[model samples]
Target: MTPRTTKPQMSVKDFEELARRAPEFVRLEFINGKVQVKPVPDGNHGEIVMWLIRRCMQQRPELSLYPEQGLKVEAYRKGRARPDGCLAPEENFVGQGEWAEPGGVLMTVEVTSRDADTDQRDRVEKPDGYAASGIPVYLLIDRDACSVTVHAEPEGGSYRSITTRPFGAVVELPDPVGITLETQKLKDYAD
Candidate 1:
């Protein structure tokens, strides 16, 4: 006879309760019926996020910036998936109202950590999710290899390989937008 093995799979409500209860600690997400806890932002992660947020804010102070916040992109679906940084275009920006709108964000940035697998997820799965949700640009800052990968041109359910820039290099943003990333800052905490 084969040995039986089992593990608990948490529901979205359970995860939400956990997040609320552990608000002071780590933020949790329910992905594929699994509870994924995001690592506390180390110094590098925090600096990068802050830099991106400042840049976006300076460019368009009128637009709202949602950084690493729980975003409910669709009804009946609640995922604690927080992008390292996200910029909501003026139109769909969550206004100073009661409930939050699913901000039709123009860009979502994910800064990779020491974990190699998470980097892969950010490169592959998360971009797919962002593209599926109509995000125009997904910038990935990979500290592990010192490179910046900008995923765009969402076609069919995924983004086509638009362009890739190395560390200390600057890549021009596509049309309708003009943004630039400073990879030099990454050298500080680069793995």
Candidate 2:
């Protein structure tokens, strides 16, 4: 005899209810109709987010890089996700609750975590989700690959243009998010 554990596929409303009651130590996301457990940030991950925050503030002072923002995503806004950072005009989320609508979001930033699902969650599913939500840009800081990939020009549930630049290069984030990043500093946090 084997002990069994069952995982039920959750709807958006159910997922939100569970997430609300979940302890602070746990972070949850729903993508592609599956419940995802987002791991806590390690020191390196925190450092990278901090680095990006500084850069975002310097280039676009009117915007803010909000960390761990829960957003309603996917087609029909049926999916829920929490990007590592969400870039939008300052005070954009003042009146919103837990899962905010994706409008007015200039970009969604994800720093790859050292987890089994990083590739699927960060690279594949998330870009699709953001693209489907019509967010203009998706920035992925790939620590393992020592690179940064920018996904822009969302259309038809995907980005029309995708560009990847290795760490230490001058990367342009494209229009709607015209910030140019000097990612040489990212090389330092690639642990």
Candidate 3:
């Protein structure tokens, strides 16, 4: 008879504990009871993230932007996500723990990396997760496709509206964050 073996599923608590103990260079996330790991982003990714942060700060001084902040996307699910950029009211994180519950988060941004699975997660699974968590916006920068996508209007565990634009175009963010983002400066990973 063949030996029976099964991979152990990690709970949200377990994931959080493991992530806390992980090295600073490692990025860890729990998605649908599965642990996902990735190395720290490259220079191009950091540049784009900083660019977006600067732009958002210039436009909305009252809001707070954090990079790679862990977020609780669902209470019932054993998963925690660390978005590339997270926008929220400054007060939301006051006296909070390491992971912020997705209550006052206005938007989350993801800049795709070289991995196809990473791109797919940003394009598909993440939107659903963010929406279900009541986040208002999910921005995806697709390096592979040279496009940016904004998803909003969360309902039924998904965003009801989506808009996509090429790298050179100006994408208008929705109200409450009424600002236009210039994507022309966003160079592809190959650059």
- Candidate 1: where is the Cα deviation over 4 Å? 1-8, 73-78, 90-101, 175-177
Q: Tell me the tens digit of each residue's lDDT in model 3 across 1-191.
A: 11111343766778889999999888887765567785478899888889889999999988878898888874344458899999987777777677877878899999888775785467776787788787888999888778889998888778888999989899998966676898888855425
Please report, as a residue range, the 10-residue window in candidate 1 with the lowest summed lDDT.
1-10
Candidate topping TM-score: 2
Candidate 2: the clashing residue pairs are none
Ten-residue region with minimum lDDT total, candidate 2: 1-10
Residue 145 alpha-carbon offset, candidate 1, angstroms = 1.4
lDDT values of the candidates?
Answer: 0.64, 0.91, 0.80
lDDT tens per residue, model 2, 40-69: 999999999999999999999999999998
Alpha-carbon RMSD to native, per candidate: 5.5, 5.0, 4.9
Residue pairs with clashing backbones, model 1: none
Scored by lDDT, model 2 comes in at: 0.91
Give per-model TM-scores: 0.78, 0.95, 0.90
Task: Judging by TM-score, tell me the better candidate of 1 and 3.
Answer: 3
Ten residues in sequence with the least summed lDDT for candidate 3: 1-10
Please provide, for model 1 over 97-188, each residue's C-alpha lDDT reduced to its tens digit, 9 standing for 90 to 100: 32233446777788886654575456665776666565677888887768888887766547775577788887665533467656676677
lDDT of 2 at 64: 97
Between the candidate structures 1 and 2, which one is better when assessed by TM-score?
2
